[model samples]
Target: MPQQYGTGMSHTYSTTSSSQPPMGTGTGKKHDGYPTYRPIGTGGTVGTIPNSMTESSKPVYKPTVTYAQTSRATVEPKSSSSPGQMYSKTRSGPSSKPTHTGDCKTPGGLPGLSKTQQILLSDTRADAINNVLTKNEHFKFSFGNKRTGGPGKGGEVVPANRKTFPALTGTGLGMAVVFLGPCGFNTPHVHPRAAELGIVTEGTIVSSMIPENGVNVHNADGTAPREILNTLHQYDATIFFQGAVHSQFNPGCGNATFVAALSAEDFGTGQVAQELFGARNNAAVADVFGDAIDGADVDKLRGAISNNVALGVEQCLKRCNINKRK
Candidate 1:
C-alpha cells in the first residue's frame, strides 16, 4: 500500500513493507523485499520512509536554477505621461534689456503727467501764444511797425500777470517784452518767486547783480562767481538766478529792447535799496549802515533809492563838459 508523509498530497513515493528497513537507513537492505530508492548523485535517500511501502509511491523532484549578470540603471517617476525625462533651470543667454517708464510721446521725453496737468499745459500754451497775437497789432504800433523799436521812442513793457492775464492762471510761467530808453535801467532788484532770463534784441546794456549775501568776493584771480562783469549786447542773453540782486542798464546811447521770461506766473520784484533802506525806520537803518552814515544822509539816500534814478550821470556830464542828452 502507498502512505502519506507530509501536509500535502501533491507528491508521493514508494518504499518497502512495515518490517523492512526505513528510507535513507543506508543499511544496504531492501524493505519488504523491495528495492530501496536513493537520490541520484547524493548517494542518500531524501527522508525516512514508512515501513509500509508500495510500488505506487513516487519521489518529489526539484527544478534546476540558474543566475545571469545584469547592469543597474536609475529611473525617476514620470511627472507627465512620458517617463525618464529631464529638465534644466539654467538660462540660455544674458538677461533682457530694462523697460522704459518715461512718457516718450511727450515733448523732451518728459515723465508721465496727470490728465489735469496735460490739459492745463495745452490750454495755457495756446492761450499764451494767442494773447501775444492779440496784442501784436498794438505792440506793432508801439514799436513803430518794426519788430524792434528805435531809440528816442523810449521803452514799454507788457507783463503777463495772473490778475491781468487770464492765460497765466495756474500756468506756472510768465513773460514780459521790454523796450528800454537810452541810458535807462531796470534797477537793482530781486524776483521774490522765480529766476529771470532775458535776451537782448537791440543795443547794448550793462547787467549787474550783487548776490543776496551782498558779498562781491572774488576768486584768487579777481574773477567773481558767474563772471566779473555781465555785459550783454544785441542778441546776447543773461539769466539772473533766483533771489539775487540784479539790474539791467542801457549803456549805449541808443534805445535797448529785450524779452524777459519768468518761471512763475506771479513773479514779483522787490528793489533791494528800497526794501532795505526805505522800508525800515531811522534807528534800524543806522544799525545797518553804522554811525558813519549820518541819520539825515540815510533819509536822503532812502529818498534817492525810492526814486530809482541813475546816479553819477550828472557828475559825468559836468566833468566831461558835455550837455546832457535825454
Candidate 2:
C-alpha cells in the first residue's frame, strides 16, 4: 500500500494524481508534471506522490494483502495409517460429529451411506477417501496442478459424495456422472439436498424436472406434480432445483453421457419408482393405484419396480436395433 501522511481529523482526500492544478494552491513545489499536495485539514494526512519519482527515489510502498485467513483452529492429522495427508477443518460440521479416524476420514453425516450401511461403508469409504488425498501428486501427473456419476442398466452412475471423497464436505459442490445405453433411462428421482446443473457430454437424451409449487410442495397438502420437459443434445445443459422430481432418457441409439454438478456434498438421491414400491405395506402401496389393477395381480408388481437405468421407448429400441432385455 502507498504510504499515508495524514494524522489528524481532516476531509478524506484521495491521493488522485490529476493533470489540472489543485482547487487551491499547493505548498509543495511541482517538479516535472507531478501533482503536489496542500495542507487543508486537521484529521487526515495529505501527501502527493510525484508522477516522475523512481522506485529508489522519494516514496516506497509494499504489498498489503493477507490471503486465506480464517478463524478456525487448524488441526493436522498425525497417524501411522495416513502419513503426510493433511486437511484444514473449520469444525463447523454437525455437533454430533463422528469420530475422526486416520486419513482425515469421518463416518457420519453421509446422508445415504450412514443409514443402513454404516458398518459396511466405513472401511470402504476410508480407503477411497485416503486414495484421493494421498495419490493426488503434484506433477509427474499434475503436469499441472490442475488436470482433471450415476446412471442406469446400460447406464452407470458415479456419485462423488463425501464418503468417496471427504475433501468435498462443506464445499457446496458435488458431482455425479450418468451414462445411458441405447434407449436407456434414468428414472425419476429427487435430490433432497442439492440442485443440479447438468451437462450432456455425449449423444442425445430427453430431460425433465418438476419443482414444488409455491411455498413448497408437501405430501400432506396434496400438491399436484407438474413436469416440464426438454431435449438435450451433445454439449447441451440444463438445471434442476433442489427437491425437484427429475428424469433423463436417451432417445438415440448410441450411448449417452451427462455430468451433474450438485449444490451439496451429501445430496441424496431417491428414485421415485423404487421408493414408491419399496414400502413394506403392500396394501398401502397397492392402494396408490386404486383399482387400476386387479388385487390378485398386485402381488406380482411388488418387486417389479424398474431399475434406475431400465429400458425406455420400445420404438427407440427397435429403431436402434437393440434387443430388449427381460
Candidate 3:
C-alpha cells in the first residue's frame, strides 16, 4: 500500500502534520501525504509568479479615435424690393403706353376731339353774319331824298338822327356822345332827370356848376341866393348832378375832346331855355333871382343866344328841396 496518511499504512510518520501546521509557522507545502514546513526565501513561489503572468503583460495598441476635418460656410440675407423700379416696369416704356378707355376715342395717336367736329364749330360764325344782313333790308326810311332836315335845321330844336343810332325807347336812361371837336365851348343847359359825367379826353377844359341866382352868396351877411362850384383842367372826371345847370369850356388852344354820358334818354329836347326865362314871365324869373334881377337884364341875356350865353350864368345849381329863406 501507498503510504496512507490518516488510514493505517506502512510508512514512517511524524507526530506533527504539515497540513495542520502550528499557528506561528513561516511557510508550508504538500508532499506525499504530508506537508513540509519551511522558512520563506528570496527565490520563493511569490517571486516566481511574475514569470507565469508574461502573456497579459505584452504592449497592447488601440487605434486613436479621429473625426474628419469639415468646413462650414457663412451665408448673407437679401435686401427688399424698391417701389420706383416696380412702377417704371409697369407704366413707363414705349411698349407700355396707357390705353384710352370709355367714351373718349383715340385717333391718329392724339387725345380729345376729332377733326370733323372742329370744322362744324367754325361754320357757326358765317351763319351769324347772314342773319344781320337779312334784318337790315326790312328797315324803312320816311324822310327820303334829303340828308339833314327835320327839327335840327331850324334853331328852335335839335332832332336826333336815327340812322346814326336808334332813339332811346326803353327807360329814361339817356344816350352818350364821344365829342372829338377842337377846344371850344359847350352851350349851358340842364337835363331834367339825368346826371352827367364829363371825362376830359384831350386838352384842358374849364367846367362849372352854378345855382339859380347869379350870386352864390346873398351878401357879406352869408344869406346867399345860390352856390357856384367850378373846377379847371381836372385830368380825371367831373360829375354834374341831375337838374344842375352846368357848362364846359375848353381853355386850351389845342383840340379837346370829351365823352359825355347822361342819364336821360332825350337831352332836354322839349325844355327850351328861351321859353322858360323870357320877360313875358318876368315874375317867374324874379321868383328864382329874388330882388337881384331887373326886367331889362333878363331880356338882354336872352338875346345873347348867338354867343351861346343866352343863359348868362356859366353853370346851373343842383336842385334841392331846402328853402334858404327859412
TM-scores for every candidate against the unseen true structure: 0.40, 0.45, 0.33
Worst 10 residues of 3 by lDDT: 83-92
Cα RMSD for candidate 2? Answer: 20.3
Q: How far does residue 202 in candidate 1 sit from its true spot (Å)?
A: 1.5
lDDT of 3 by residue, 158-257 (tens): 2222222232222345444323122234434567767877777566555666545554555778775453434445355888777766655544434454
Question: Model 1: what TM-score?
Answer: 0.40
Q: In model 1, where is the ten-residue run with the lowest total lDDT? A: 65-74
What is candidate 3's TM-score against the reference? 0.33
After superposition, candidate 1 runs with Cα above 4 Å error: 1-156, 214-228, 279-326
Candidate 2: segments with Cα more than 4 A from true spot: 1-152, 213-225, 279-312, 323-326
Report every candidate's CA lDDT. Answer: 0.48, 0.53, 0.36
In candidate 2, what are the lDDT values of residues 1-326, reduced to their tens digit?
Answer: 11122431121122222221233323333444545543222222356765588655643211121122234433332222232222223334455556665434334434444322443454564554453344443112211122122212445566777655555654577888776766666656799999999999999878877777663344775864555677899899999999887877777878888889999978998866557666444665433222121112223332432222232355566687766433
Query: What's the true lDDT of residue 100 in model 1?
Result: 39
Candidate with best lDDT: 2
Could you tell me the lDDT of residue 110 within candidate 1?
A: 41
Model 3, CA-based lDDT: 0.36
